[model samples]
Target: MVYIIIHLHGRYFIMKQGLFHCEIGMADKLAMVVFSGTVDRLMPVGIIASGAVAMGLDVEVFLTFWGLNSFRKESLTSNTKMSRDYEDMAPMMMQLMKTKNVPSWFDTLKKAKEIGNVRIHACAMTYDLMNMKKEDLADIVDDVMAVGEFVDIAKDAKFTLFI
Candidate 1:
């Protein structure tokens, strides 16, 4: 089989005229396991994903449980929940962010997707447990994936972080 190497942005992706597209070569991956629903934890997911993509790495974010909840279309914009460790400070911090004109976590992640190869996968198990359909999730979510499938992708990541 013959393949052509295309450099889009910073990553090199292999493509063939009549075959499925897959990434190969110098393109590293940054995998993230986002398990937290709170804004405090979610913020880093977006920031880190953005940074990784800017540096020419593919980002695979697996959203499970609470993290998946935060991606629901209904709550994506309205969420104000904070981590338990800073529960009491949530109000003040939220207000501060608003005053400082800081973008919401969802917005940050959305921008990252626009700028680079960032794939956001919703957990299929979590979706079933939460009784959610594909439409229930925000548009930024690429598709539903099983943990095993996600593991297959994450196993070879240059580095993986749980947030």
Candidate 2:
């Protein structure tokens, strides 16, 4: 016997015995969250990654710009420097944190990766722009990739978000 299954949005309908049956919405099956912000900026991404993993979704995180620096294998403890173009300066915040002896965003990201299935990738173009090699990146990163590579990875994803 064959069961006819129809999916609308997050709802699933199964047709049987001339009757329609529905199943509750399941969590996302796959997700690709691209992170272009600083490591500290990745806190929310980390939470999302962990939450997705908890919900049994495959999660991939693409790290670019200052975000790449958060995953260095050996030195996962660097603070991100705000770009010169940033209108609202965060240096004062950083300074205050330093005064308070708070760990940098890098450390938090490392902890998150350690506790979750977060796959981190550094952008090759940004690597070249900054004259940084893959070896220069933090240890938590899973790979260094080109934009094409990342796009290819994200191609079959069921959900994609840029943050």
Candidate 3:
């Protein structure tokens, strides 16, 4: 009983061989292109990842631009900015979350990984352009990959969002 999984053009195709040889389509994956660094925006990424994994779907996150920056070791704690539209309310929101004992966005994302498979990939070009090494990134990040590779991986995903 040999099984192979193939993802193409935003669809998953499973191939079964030997005793059975056939292709089966499935949409059990989530792919996200995280490009923002704002706290509000990043929070949703964590929630979505957690929910997707809870539903038994694999999650692949491509962190590029500001998103990659936020994943840096230093920024993980220091980056407190929120979306510009809601900039003025950041302080209040932060305080409210703290008062309510809500975990930080990064912590939420880490929690999701603990429950299921979650691969976080940094954009190779951004990683190099920013002059950062793998050590500078958080442990949650799986690796650095080019845009093409990320796109290829995302193509087979059932839901791909740019957050």
RMSD per candidate (Å) reads 3.9, 7.2, 3.8
Predict model 2's lDDT versus the native.
0.63
Error of 2 at 120 (Å): 1.3
Span of ten consecutive residues with least summed lDDT in model 2: 26-35
TM-score of the candidate numbered 2?
A: 0.58
* Reference-based TM-score of each model: 0.87, 0.58, 0.86
- Tens digits of lDDT, candidate 3, 113-152: 9997889999999999999999999999999999999999
lDDT of 2 by residue, 1-163 (tens): 5678777644467877656766645435344444445544555666666666766665667777656644545445444545456526677767777799865555554555566456677787777777877677766677778888778767756778877
Clashing residue pairs in all predictions, respectively, total: 0, 7, 1
TM-score of model number 1: 0.87
Return the top candidate by lDDT. 1
lDDT of 1 by residue, 115-136 (tens): 9899999999999998999998
Once fitted onto the true fold, the runs of candidate 1 whose alpha carbons sit more than 4 angstroms away are 1-24
Worst 10-residue lDDT window for candidate 1 reads: 18-27
- Global local distance difference test of model 1: 0.91
